[model samples]
Target: MAAALAAAAAAAAHHHRLSSSSPAARTRVVHHHHRRRRSSSLSFSAPASSHGCPRGARALRRAAAGDGGGNGSGGVSTGTVDPAAASSPSSSLEELYRSCATWTWRGMRVNYLVRGEGPPLLLVHGFGASVGHWRRNIGVLSESYTVYAIDLLGFGASDKPPGFSYTMETWAELILDFLDEVVRRPTVLVGNSVGSLACVIAAADSSRDLVRGLVLLNCSGGMNNKAIVDDWRIKLLLPLLWLIDFLLKQRRIASALFERVKDRSNLKDILLSVYGNKDAVDDELVEIIRGPADGEGALDAFVSTVTGPPGPSPIALMPAVAARSPVLVLWGDRDPFTPIDGPVGRYFSALPSELPNVTLHMLEGVGHCPHDDRPDLVHAKLLPWLDTLPSTTALTPVSSPAA
Candidate 1:
């Protein structure tokens, strides 16, 4: 159900030619650069959840015993996957899963984990996803940098209270707070899909120096609304979105829908739809995603996120964010929702022209979440770019330019 709803959100923004006074946006040929877009909320601060592994390191380690226990928080090992066959040769899947941790924020548990050292790097998952989503990249990136992967509030082990708004601003605030209170450093944020939008907002935040850099993978164009700009995609999907948005809001109905989609078979099918690499959509991956849906607040959070307002698009957030920080924009050219040939793609293609500091890479034949679908390809491009950036010690001064 979550995947279905998320797909709708992406569809609405597929045809957008951003309402940019920028010359590039104005001249963007219709259907030439497809860009698809696809967020949450609440208030009050909970006591600082221990920045340390919340589930406790020992409990997480025990998850390696088998998938029978339901205790793991945010790593793929939170379920079970053949450690031998994972993408990273250096670390087993079970070891990665053992890193799962939990933090309390605003009266709810937020699941996350940390690994390695050096400058802090945080991974934010997209809609219906958790830290486990980044299993492939975390182990490799952690070799040189402290890699933190978290299940956003209402997803994974995070507490999902009823009545949360589930908007972009909501998640952005949480990201900022997590940086200040947990990682306790100005850090680079790497996000996929909706998570990318949250990182954009966090980097632009006026209140904190939490984000030092950003990497957006197959970034969503909008939050939860239809196309923000004038486009046929909006006209085409508005009615369908209206229906899904309505159906998702009902409690019993939402739960029923969740049950159907959470089925292992249904889950695999949905994953295959978005993941371009057919081989990667294995049973373990499906179980990892399905595992979180049964947890508390999962259904409610899904409904809220699905029916929620569309947050600012990259067009809306990029100018200010790019001025303050360097951004690496990655797009899977084969993304069905936001084809590289669609409006979203055009917007990204035009980015380098507007912000010379921005680096954009188009991955051929990949889908919505390139980081997960092709970790090797993503890392091949990512690590080199990361090396070029100044050290964390050098980054703070750039963010503030101390007098």
Candidate 2:
């Protein structure tokens, strides 16, 4: 049977890791401050399938989505913000991104949303996405657990300080620091794409084990573009990446390109192409992504992130984090940016068998933004896993401080 073969393959991979001190086992990631390293050889483009912005990746996504058509598979809605205004959907959506609270991080105001009052849950969004991306799940998830969704400083209502360095390690540091200063309790980190990678890095490198569990939704290969440089796709995308990087350096061109990509029409098309469930691409979703572009340093952040260094890969960070906290991976098989068949996806697909702490569920017919594309499915698996994690109150070290 196919399942038998998969089990055999997983067993062989696990055996290989056991044979030698696995690269994953030996890899010890430290704070980005000390170990801040970037990929120099290849100016690889970020995965085309992520949320939006960073011109090159968006273009690639359009091409990929064109080649790969979407399906009508959508999750049933669990609940809406306001059922009374169901016919006029926008009215219900308006109630989603309101009542936000702010927290100071490094002298800048970082926007966040907090709700229910049980165990804490920190939601981190992918590149070009903000807390509004979780509009559907926030209300539902909050009913059982205290949910906190942050804008990650550079995106959403958070401070977009121009010329500021944006890297996965920096975001990871922000998450860890947020846990220490803000949450101040053991919390579950639920992240998507680059957000997931940031959580992995934070959980792996932090001095304290403030994270109780991890829910990774299609974790990305690297922060920016550079990841596994040897992948055939990266080799093919080299010239395009170079060209885009060059164009982004020019202020006028960068601004013009940013303008085009952030347009509501373009965003809808991009979202449609990547999402298996096309109905989920509502006007509010487009506004959530588009509204941030008008910010003071938004354009600069876009260019810098697209051209910036690709931080540490999750492949190298997961081993340490998994050894400490339970990990639940929910991947949308239809993702184009980090396709389920790609290097990052394949690595995670095999992880659950290799490590007992990991659990992966390939959401059938889902796309890159699994959380939003099919909240019903993501919640079905996520909510149960979260309930199973043992509650913790103290700050214990996640990994050995000495890298």
Candidate 3:
């Protein structure tokens, strides 16, 4: 009986071992199999959980892994938050300003300041200036329209890539790209001095539909015979003009040149305030301005613009632009660039005898930058014109000029 019992006990022990070692008896056999298969081959299957584990438990494990065990909800845990989502809207705007977009057409990175919400309006600054030049007008204009004041590549906090020549055509192309990509809508282009010339050129080009209307401040490209009479001092200093131009090419030198102006303190403060506020003005902005001012490429650009090949003059482009869009010529009665002393009626007469849509407004006691010098006067004329246009339709004239 004892021998039989011993044999029976041994058999029972063997059975127990077989049952425990079998694949069906192993608690994690399926998980092990899946892991091995996943390890050996490429698959996009959802991971398998340990045996007897609930779906909630598996999710908790994943959350813990992702969140490092600190509040493991897994829906954008605070510990693993995205930096972009964390940034404020104002911070994003600052980022945009610091890193202006570049258009390949002209190897210039145009710096633009965008503000407010409404129809689009593009503000272009004069020679040797940047977007900061429109500091006074941006805030007010933003109330009525989405305002975009841009630094024409070489002038502002933009990249002055070497070997690139700054011409009206190149600058106009950059403006066109900014209008199409950045603004993403038709725009009312308002330009001052040389900027006005660029606006006329851009508006004249029929291919671009973004430029819907134009507001020319101290409109250039017209007869400036009065500039000769009023700027007698400039003519007297003509011999030193090239040297002055060369010196102004450097930011530091340009700053010093302004020191000789009658109102040096006010002018310097204004320039510094615009280019760089006391807090922001640093070596970087100085370096950016210096590159275009002192470099050979910038010098070539300046020389070309100041005394370069003339395209169809402003008078020529005016008719074409007027045919496409209503033109509003806003002149500063005291404009130093294009004085109002000349026979103004005769100048207008030289162009199409009559532009039924074109209107001229003379702002009193303003200078070259009427938008800056007289924002109220500019607003007075601008708001009414904008009001006349349909809410959904941009004011683009349909007529085309004969070549």
RMSD in Å for all candidates: 13.6, 15.9, 31.5
Write down the TM-score for model 2.
0.76
Ranking, lDDT, top scorer first:
2, 1, 3
User: Ten consecutive residues with minimal summed lDDT in candidate 2?
Assistant: 39-48
lDDT of 2 by residue, 29-140 (tens): 2222334222111111221111112212334333322322211112222333232222122213344455566666555677777766677899999888888888867766
Of candidates 2 and 1, the better by lDDT? 2
Off by over 4 Å in 3: 1-107, 222-304, 343-353, 392-403
* lDDT tens readout by residue for model 3, 212-308: 7887776655212212322454465444444444543444433332223213343333334332113223333333334335433343344334433
lDDT of 3: 0.49
Name the candidate, 2 or 3, with the larger TM-score value.
2
lDDT of 1 at 364: 62
lDDT of 1 by residue, 13-58 (tens): 3432334212311111112111211111222232222122222233
